[model samples]
Target: MFCDLIRGAAEVSICYEDATAIAFLDIQPVNPGHVLVVPREHYEVLQDIPKAVGAHLYQVATKLIPLVQTASNATDMNIVVNSGAAAGQNVMHYHIHLIPRKEGDGFDVPLPFPGSVMPNRQQLDAMAARIGSMLRDPLQNDGMKLG
Candidate 1:
């Protein structure tokens, strides 16, 4: 599917492209100027992508933000990625969504919870420490040289 897009055979409008990644206007957009940024190489999910490639995808996405905002005259934007099937990922390839937001755009953004819960300091600290301990050096594990 993506190979077709890259080759200009998919009939989708191309917005930006470089050697590492490509950004295109989403055919079914939430709002005008919505784009999807994808790496040139296949990566099924976030974890499957090399850290440097993933960073490049995001870097391209970030660079396009101002352009999308100006073109759409959007007040804000949402950078989204549905990583898995359960999380609404229909495309097998990894991509970052660039959804432009304007006032009364008719899209209701939902929160993870209806109300915020304040966790105790001890609980928060413990959770942070546990997560920090599990973070591996990508270079040591995968030999990824991220700039």
Candidate 2:
């Protein structure tokens, strides 16, 4: 049953595999070199994923980050998951999204612009600076300083 599921995977350009987990390309990708990391055993979503399976899947996903960046020539990437129908999950199989991102991809996965209220250049720059500063020391003001 599990073998069949893995076999049915189409448009997969597998970069890594193991006894328990496998990482492959996403057929209907939002961007180039988008990949899916999945466990060999079938699971509907994050809540159903076994602890061992989840651990191995995450390990493989972490290891593939650098590879994805190098292969796709991207400066950054997004690791995402849509668990259910409400969350936009079309597939029953549990998987992780490894999307390689460039400067301008026309698809904003993190931020969305609803309506016509767009921020001016100054506002945008201020927002960017705030985010950058927070990112530099995320735990500082949050009372959880990093070492």
TM-score (all chains, Cα) for each model: 0.82, 0.69
Please report the candidate that would top lDDT against the real structure: 1
lDDT of 1 at 105: 94
lDDT of each: 0.87, 0.81
Score candidate 1 by lDDT: 0.87
State the displacement of the C-alpha of residue 88, model 1, in Å, after optimal TM-score superposition: 1.8
- Candidate of highest TM-score: 1
lDDT of 1 by residue, 121-147 (tens): 999999998755555566444544334
Model 1: how far residue 105 lies from native, Å: 0.9
**Model 2 agreement with the true structure over 18-126: per-residue lDDT tens digits:** 8988888887787888989988787888988866788888889889998999989999989998898888888877789999998888768556636558879999999
Return the TM-score for candidate 1, rounded to 2 decimals.
0.82
RMSD in angstroms, all models?
Answer: 3.2, 8.3
Spell out the clash pairs found in candidate 1.
Answer: none
